[model samples]
Target chain A: MTARRLPSGDFDVEQLTPGVRRPIKLRPWLIFAGVVVVAFFGLIFSRVSLDRSGFELDDLEEQIAIEEARRGDLRVEVARLQDPNRINAIAAEIGLVYPTVRIEIEVPGLDVEGIDPEFRWAQLKAVLTAQP
Target chain B: MVLGVAFVVAWAGIGFRIVRVQGFEADKHAERGEQQRVRTEALTAPRGTIYDRDGVELAVSIDAVTVTANPSHMEDPAAAARLLAPLVGVPKSVLKERFTKPDSQFAYIARRLESAQAQEIRDMVEETEMAGVYFTSEPKRIYPAGDLASQVIGFVRDDDMAGLEGLEWKYDEALAGTPGQQIVERDPYGNPIPQGEFVVDPAQPGADIILTIDREISSAAQQILAQAVKDYNALAGTVLVMDILTGEVLAMVNAPTFDPNDRSDANPEAYRNRAVTDVYEPGSTLKVVTLAAALEEGVVTPSSILKVPGTLEVGDKEYTDVGRTKAKKMSVAEIVAKSSNVGTILIQDLLGNEKHYEYLSAFGLGQVASGDLPGEASGRLENVRDWCDTTCGPSTAIGYRVDVTPLQMASVFSAIANDGVLVEPHVVREVISADGTRQRYEPTERPVVSEETARVMRVLLQGVVESGTGSRALVDLYTVGGKTGTTEKFVPGEGYSEEDRIASFIGIAPIDEPRIVVAIVLDSPSGETEDGSDMRFGGVSAAPVFAAIAEAALHRLGVPPNVR
Candidate 1:
C-alpha cells in the first residue's frame, strides 16, 4: 500500500499490487434445493393431470351407461311396435281380409321340387315378375 | 405462581389428548373416515333377452327406476304421499300409511317404473323440494307380445326379476349373469372422487336366447284357440305347432293364458303350460303306436283284413268304437281310418304286450319328452312287467290306461311325419353368450320305425282325414293327414267324469312331403257343431282347430299348396 499527499492536504490510499484470487465452488445445498423445487412442481402437475383424466373417465362411463339404457328402451319399443296382435288389429281396421279363394298360378319351367324353401320363394317371385 | 402452574397443567392435558388421538386411536378413526369416503358398490349384470325365431323380442329386460323413501327424513309425510300417489298409480292413503310409519327409515314407494314415468316423479320431487324420496336404477322384465306364448315364455318376480315360470325358469342360470363389485371413493353426492382410490371388477352379461317360436304363427294360434275355447265353452285348450324336420316348436298356444307383464289378477292355473306339464288320456292318439308296432312287426299290412266288432270284452272292461253298431270285415287302413277300438285291440293282441311296450317306449311315452321346459311331466307309463295280465294290454291297445302330454302326442305325430325319426322336441333354438359365444340346441334323434312303415302310416292317416273321423281337419288346398282322439277325462279322486271329455286332434300337412305337425287338445268341449256333430268328439271340435291352425301356420311357413 502507498499514500500520496498533495497541496490540498488530503491523503489518498491505493493498493500498488493485486491480491491473490480464490476459485469459486458450487454449493451442494443450493443444487439440491433447486432439484427439489422442480420435482415438487412436476409431481403436482402430474397429479392434476391424473385427476382430470379420472374425471373424464368417470364422465365417459356415465355416458356409456346412459346410451346403453337408451338402446334398451328403443329395443323394447321396437318389440312393442312389432306386436302381431296390434298389427292384426290395425290391418282389420284398415279393412284388410284374407281372400276366400286363392288362385294358383303354375309357371312353366319353375319347378320348385328339391329346392330350398327360401330359394324357391325367390325363384317364384322372379318368375312371376318376369311374366308381368 | 398459581397462574403459571394452572397454565402448565392445561398445556399438558392438551398435549396428551393430541398424542392419544394421533397414535393410540388412529386406526379406528381412520377406518371410520374410510367408511364415509370409500364405498364398496355392487354392479348389476344385465339379464338375457328372449327372442323368437324371427328375431322378434318376446321377453326383454329394460332399465327401470324404483322409488324409495327415508320416511324419517320427510318433513310432511302426508303431503308427500298425496303428491306422489297419482304419479305412482297408488292410493294416497296407502302411500301416507307407508310414509308415516313410526321411526321408519325406509319404505318402497314404487318399484320398476318406466324411465319416463320415473323421470316425471323425479322432476316433481325436485320442483317440490321433497327431501325423502330417492330413485335408483333397476331392471324390469316385460313381455311385449302380451298374452302371446305367455305360458311358454313365462314371467319374473317384480322385486328381483327372478324367473317364475316357462323358459325363464328353465334357463335362469344362463339368463342371469355374474354381478360385479367396485371399491371407490365418492363425494357427498355419490359422485366418484377424481384420482381417488378406485378398483373395479366388471360384470359379465347374460347369454341371449333364441327360441323356435314364430311370433306371427303364435299370435294366430292364440287368437284362434282363444276363440275356439270361447265358442266351445271349454275349460282350457292347447295348440302346439312343431317343425317335423328339426323338432322345433313353431307355436305353442295355451288358452286361459295370463300376460306375463301384469299378472296381478291372473289365475294361478292359467300359468300352467298344459302342453308340457298336464297329461290326459291320449285316447285314439295312442292307437298310432299300436298300428305302427303291428306294421313294424309284419303282423299287419295296410290291406290286411280284420273282423272288428262293435264291442270287445277284456277282463271286466268293455271297448267299443264310436259310430259303429255292427260287426264288419275291414282292411287295417279302414280300421285305422275309422278309429276302431276293437280293431286296434285285435292288432295289439297280434303285436303282443311286450312288443307293444317296446313301441311305446320307442315313441318316447312315459318319459319327459323335452328337457328344455320346466315342470314337464313324463306321462305315466307302466312297465310291461307291472302290467296287469287281465286288461292292461287290451285297454292300452284301445288308447286306455295310458297318459300323455300334448307335447308328447305332438312328438308322436312328428315322428311319423319325419320318416319315423323321433326327434326330441325343444323350444330353445340357441343361446348366445355375452362374449358372442353361441350354443345351439342339438335335439336327440332316434329311429322309431322304418321309413316305409311311416309312409304307410301316413297314407292311413291321410285316409282318416280324407273320408273318416278326422275329415273336419282338412285344410283348403292342402293334402293333410291326422287322427282324432276322444277320451272320458279321468278325475283323480273320482271316477271318469260323465260330462267331461278330452277331445284332441294331431295332424300333418302336405302329407307327401311333411313339414309341420299341429296338435290341438280341448278340455270338456260340450254342445254340438253347426252341423249337429257332437262337440265332445275330437273330430267335431278339436279337428277344426287343427285345420285353422295348420292352414295359418303353413301359409306363414310359406309352404306351397299341394292339393292343386
Candidate 2:
C-alpha cells in the first residue's frame, strides 16, 4: 500500500486493498422480551389442561357415587324378595302346602352303601343314558 | 431542611412497617387464609352384614336419610308441622312444639328414615317452597326375615347403630369398623376447589359374619313354638335345634318374639333368649345323667334290677314317682322309661355324690355350655363340698336342688347324640374380614363317656320315646328318643306354685344315626289337651312340639327316613 500528499498540507494515503464489513450485534432487552412472552403462554396452557382434568374427575366421582347408591338399593330389594314369611304367605295364597309324606323311589343298580347321594345319582344317570 | 427531614422520617416509618408485616407475620396471615378454604371431614365406615348358613341376609345395613330442621328459618311453623306430620309419622302437635321453640336453631325432625320416604319428603318440601328442612344420609340396620330369629340375632340402637342385644352385642367390636378422615379445600358455596389441597384416608369396612342358623328350620321351629305357646295357654316358650355332629345350632326360637324392624311397642321381656338365659329344675329329664353316671362307673347295667318303694323320705323332703304307689322291682331301662323318681334316687345311692358331680361337670353343667351366646347362664350346680349329704344327693338325683338352662339340657342330649363327645355349641359359623380373610369357628370337644356306653344310654333313652313318658315325641318314619321334664314353677321371693309348671323335652332324631338334638321348653302351660291329657306335663305339651320341630328340621336337612 502507498500514500500521496494533498494540496491542503495534510498527509494523503492511497488504499491498495478493498474495504471489509463488520457483523451486526443483537439487543439484550429484545431477547429478554421474547422469552417472557413464550413463558406466559406456556403457563396459561398448562393451567387450562389442569382445570379440565379436575372437572372430568369431579364428574366421574359423582357418577360412581350414584351407581353405588343404585347398587345398594338393588341389594336391599333382593334381600326383601327372599324373605321367608313373604314366600310362605305367597305359597299359601297359591294353595301350596307341605306334603304330609315324602316318598323315596329306589332305582335298580344304584343301591350302593356308603356312597354319596350325588355320586349315586350320577351313576344312575349314566346307566339310564347307556340303556338309551 | 426541616421539610426534607420530615419526608425522610415518614418514608423510614413506612419501610419499617412493610418489613414487619412481610417478614414476621407472613406465616400467620397465610394460615388464616387457608383456614377459610380448607376443611376436614369425617368419613363413616359401613357396618357389617349378618348372613345365615345359606348366605341369606338376616340383618343388614343400608344407607338411610335423617331429616333435620333449623327452626329459626321457618316462616310458618304450624303449616310446616302440618305438612311434615304424616310424612315423618310424628304428631303435628309434637312437631309444632319443636318448631316453635324459642331461639332454637336445630331440631331433629326424624332419624333414619328409609330412602324412599326421605325422597318423598324432599319432593314435598321442594314443591311447597318450604325452608329450614335438610336431609343427611346415614346407616340404618334392618332385619329382612322379620321375626324369624329376632331373639338370636338381636337388634341395634336406632341412633348410632350400636348393638344392644343378642349376637349383635357379642360381636359388636368386629362388626363396627374404623372410621377415616379427609382434608379438602372448598369454595364459599361448599364446592370442591380444583387444583387445591386434597388428602384422604379411606375408611375400612367392618368384617362380615356368617351364622350357623338355618332360616327354614328356624322359621319352622318359631311357628311350632308359637302355636304350642298359644295352644297350651302358656306364658312363653323356647325351642332349640342343633346339629350334634358339627355343634352348629340350626334353630333357636323364642315365642312372643318382637320384630326388630319396628320395636316401638315391643315387650322387653320377650327380648331375652330364654334357651340360653333362663334356668329351671330339669325334672325327670336329668334322670339320664344319674343313669349315665351309674352306667359309666360300672355301678349298674341296663338290665340291673332295683327294688323301688312308693316314696322315699330324706332330709324332711319326700320323693315319689309319678303314677306309682306300690313298691316294685324295675330294671334300669324300665326306670328311665317310667321316669320313676324313686328308682332314680336309688340309682343315685349307688353312684355317690363325688361320682355324680363328676359326670354332671363332664356333661357341661355348672358352666356356660357355649360362649357364642350373650348372657348364657352357667346353670346352678352346687359344689360337692356344699352338698348336704342327706337330701342334696337324693334331691339332685330326682331332678331337684339343681338348675339348668334349656341349652345346657340340649347340650347334654347332644353329647349322647354325638357319641359321648361334648362338643362346644356355637352360633357363629365364620367371620370374613373386609379384605376377604376368613376366621372359622372351631368347636372344642371333650369325651364324656365311652362310645359303647353312649350307645347303651341312647338305647335306654329310645325305650322312653317308644313306649315311655316321651312317647308323644315320636316322629313318623323316623325313630327318635328323648326324656320328659316337668318342674314345679319356682318364683323368686315366693315358694313353688302348684298351679304353674315348666314342661320341657329334649330329643334326638334317627337314633341309629343321630343328626340333630331338639330341645323344647314351655313356661307356665295350663289347660289340658283335647284328649284330657294334662298340659302341664312335658309329655303332653313339650314332647309334641319336639316332634313337630324334629320332623320339619329332619326333612329340611334331607335326612332320608331310616325307619320303615
lDDT of 1 by residue, B365-442 (tens): 999999899999999889999999878998898678889999999999999999999999999999999999999999
lDDT of 2 by residue, B427-459 (tens): 999999999999999999999988888899899
Which ranges of candidate 2 are over 4 A from the true structure? A1-56, A101-132, B1-29, B68-110, B119-135
Name the best candidate (by DockQ): 1
What's the DockQ of model 2?
A: 0.36
**Span of ten consecutive residues with least summed lDDT in model 1 chain B:** B155-164
Tell me how candidate 1 scores on lDDT.
0.91
Question: How much is the lDDT of residue B286 in candidate 2?
Answer: 90
Model 2 lDDT, residue B410, Cα:
91
Give the clash count for model 2. 0
Q: Give the C-alpha lDDT of model 2.
A: 0.90
